[model samples]
Structures are given as structure tokens and as C-alpha cells.
Target: MTGFVVRRIGFYTFVAVVLAFFALPLLWLVTAPFTDTPTYEVKVPDFTPANFQAIVEHPYALGSLVNSIILAVGTAALVVLFASLAAYALSRVRLPGRDALLYALLLLSSIITGTAAMVPLFQLAVTVGLIDSQLGLILILTGGLLPAAIFMLKDFMDSTPKSYEESARVFGASPLQIVGHIVVPLVRPGLATIAVWALANVWGNFLMPYLLLSDVEKQPAAVIMYTLYTEGGQPNLRLLSTFGLLYSIPVVLMYLFVSKKYGFRFHGGIKR
Candidate 1:
């Protein structure tokens, strides 16, 4: 009885500490936005929405926000669709070199990093005349993000029993029909988790967009946020806080909506 009680107490203490670590910075940011501007100083006992207003009304800032939304949604949808198809094939099909292909994919995924590939990626996009475009960034981000998304969905599909697909096939179902009618339905939770993760990645990416896109109007929120910090002079703490919070709202809302609607099972391995 004493051991069980100690375990419970330790668990609660860990939870509390973790929560505080994550929440404190956000709390400080929220309050900072309300501070007075020009100096962009955080004033005590004074917090207002004026700084947020300035950001929303600014053309560059507002355009960046819109560009972020478009790219995030586009990348998420693309990753989920392509990854789902690839993962389904990997999980369900039997081919001569399927295992070898899967190993190669995993190997390639481990070695590729956006920062390392940035120069070639920029030159390639420039050659294709994709530089300085939202679509260019979207395509580049999607290529890097899809492999991991496929791996995530593949694990989820592996957890499901083969009987599900076998039964569908026995009923005279076509491949497309089986995927559409059986595989996708069983993997809904995993797909939701993948979409949420993909959107978050695209929204937060800075280096690729910063390299390929120079047009202020085509830049995503993360890029603009960096410019606001590094180039716009000494940190305007108030404006910085305000825009940061606003910038985060879309991702936070997505996480909230996804978590509320769907319980995610992200653990590895298939339970027999």
C-alpha cells in the first residue's frame, strides 16, 4: 500500500512540473503582447489588444498569415493522401523486394535533412522557376515531411489485423475499393494524427521558405516572424508577443480540435 501511494504521488508531481514548464512561456508571451509599444516595452498593469491590431492591419504581416494557412493546409492534405496510399501498399502487399524497399526508405529518411539539402533545393527550384512562390515552398516541405508521415501511418496499419483486408478481398472487392472501403476507415485516427503533425511541420518551417521565397507576400508566417525579430531592430517585446500569439493561434486551434474530436494512439508496434 505504501509503495502504490508513493508511485501515485511521484506521478502527480511529474505531471505538475511538466505542465508548468510548458505553460509558463506561453503565459509570459500572452501577457507581453499587451504591453505598450514604440519602445515595445512590457508595461506592468497595462495589457491591451492594440499591438495585435497593428499586426493584423499590416499588409506584410497579414499576407504572411494567409500564406501560412494555404501552405499548411496544402501540405497536410498532400502528405496524408500520398502517405496513406504508400503506407497501405507497404503494410498489405507482398512483393519480391518489398522489405528491401522499405529498408531503403527508412535509410533515406534518416540521412536527409532540410538544412543539408537547402542549396540544391534552392537551385532546383530556381531552375524550375518555382523560386519566390508559395507553391514552391509547399512542394519542398511536402517531399521532406511525407516519408515520416508514411512511417507513422504504416505503424498504425500494421497494428490492424490482416483479416480485415482478407475479408474485403473475399467479397470481390477491387484494390481501390478495398483501400477506400476498408483500409482508410480503420486508419482514421492515424490519418488525423498525421494531418495534425504535417500541418504543424509546414507551419513552423523557416529555412526552406526563407531560401526559396524572397517575395514578402509569398512568405509564410514563420519567415515573417523571424524578419520581425532579427531585421526589424531590437526586439519590440510588445509587438513581438502580440504577433507571436496570433501566429500560434491556428496551430493551437488545430491541436485542440483534433485532440477533442479524436483520441490519438501514437505508440509503436502491433499488439497481437
Candidate 2:
């Protein structure tokens, strides 16, 4: 009995330690922004708005947030639209070597990561007069994300009831109409999942935006956040913590809204 009680105590202690390990960073993030002089340590904040005032006065801080919104929304919209169509077609069609092709594309995308393909991507963008353009960045991000998005959405498409499509066809509904009305409604949860995924991916992305956009005004929050440092290479914890909280809000809000709406379940064709 003593040994069992000791084991139970040990387990609870370990769980508490693990929880504290993850919780401390979040605690710092919440408390530091309001501190008069924030630091690495999580101390009681002085509850000052000076940090936010400083960010508001900064030239590019708020504008960079707007740029991030534009990039994340545009890329997510394109990814959802294209991924849905491609996944639907792939699911419905019986083409030779289609599965092999999908797997090949997925493998290639994974192996040839963004870092490896940036040179070719940059040259292509330059050649096409897309350099320093937000649209170009969106297109590049969309292409890179499509393979995985399609692979995931394809499962949803497969799980969808084909009888609904056949019924629509019997009523003389065209393929596009059927897809727009029938398939889309059933797979909306999957679509929301893809949109959130893509948005988060593009929101936190820095490398592509940093390399593609040379103009300071055009850079997103991810890029602007990097400049929150002193000339001596020390991080300005005040502005950094404040901006970090503000930067995290939009995505968190989006996730909450989506989660409340659809519960983030992979229901596919099963109507909720």
C-alpha cells in the first residue's frame, strides 16, 4: 500500500512539473507586456500602457500587422479554393497513376523544402516581374501549401457520399453546380480546417516575406518583429513582448471562432 501511494504521489508531482514548465512562458508573455520595464523573469507588472504607446508611435509596427493580415488571408483563400477543387476531382476521377502522382508531388514538396527551392522561386519571381509584390508571395506560398492541403482534403472528399452527386446529376445539375452546392456544403469543416492551417502557416512565416519584399512598408509583422532590437543586438523586451501579444491575438481569435463554429472535427460528409 505504501509503494502504490508513493508511485501515485510521484506521478502527480511529475505532471505538475510538466504543466509548470509549459505554463511559465505563457505567464511571462501575459505579464511582461504590461510591465513598465519587462524582463526575462516573470515578476509582478507595474501595469503601464507605455509599451503599447511606443508601438503605436513606431512607423511600421501597426502597418506590418495589416500586411500580415493581407498575406495570410489571400494565401488561405487561394489554398482552400484550389485544394478543394483538386481534391474533389482526384477523389471522383479514376485516372491511371493518379495516386502515384499525388504521392509523388507530396514527396517532392517535402524533400525540396522552401529553403532548397528559394533560389529558383526568387529567380522565377524576378523573371515574371513579381519581385517585391505581395501577389507573387501569395502565389508562391499557395503553391507550396497546395500539395499537403490537397492530400488532407482528399480524405474528406473520399468520405463524402457520392450518392448526393449522382442525385444532383439526375436533376440535370452540371458538375460545377453540383460541386458548388453539394460537395462544398458537406466538406466545409475540412475547408475551415485548411483555411486555419494555411492562415497560421502564412502568419508566422518570415523567410519568404523577408526575402521577397525589399520595401520596409511592404513587410509583414513576422519581418517587422525581427527589427525589434537595439543596435547592440539586444532585444527590446518592452516592445517585443507588447507586439508579441498583439501579433498573437488575431490568430487566436480566428481559431476560437472556427472552433466554436465547427468544433474542428473531421466529420467530412457527416452533417453535424
Instruction: Name the best candidate (by lDDT).
Output: 2
Question: lDDT tens string, model 2, 1-272?
Answer: 99999999999999999999999999999999999999899999899999999999999999999999999999999999999999999999999999998999899989998889999999999999888999999999999999999998999899899998999999999999999999998999999999999999999999999989999999999999999988898999999999999999998899899989988777865454
Candidate 1 lDDT tens digits, 52-157 = 7888777788888888999999998999999999998888778898777777776787787898888888888989999888877788888998877887788888
lDDT for each of the candidates? Answer: 0.81, 0.94
- In the predicted model 2, the residue pairs found to clash are none
TM-score of each: 0.84, 0.97
Model 2 off-target regions past 4 Å?
269-272
In model 1, the clashing pairs are none
Per-residue lDDT for 245 in model 2?
A: 94
Model 1, 90: alpha-carbon shift in Å? 1.5
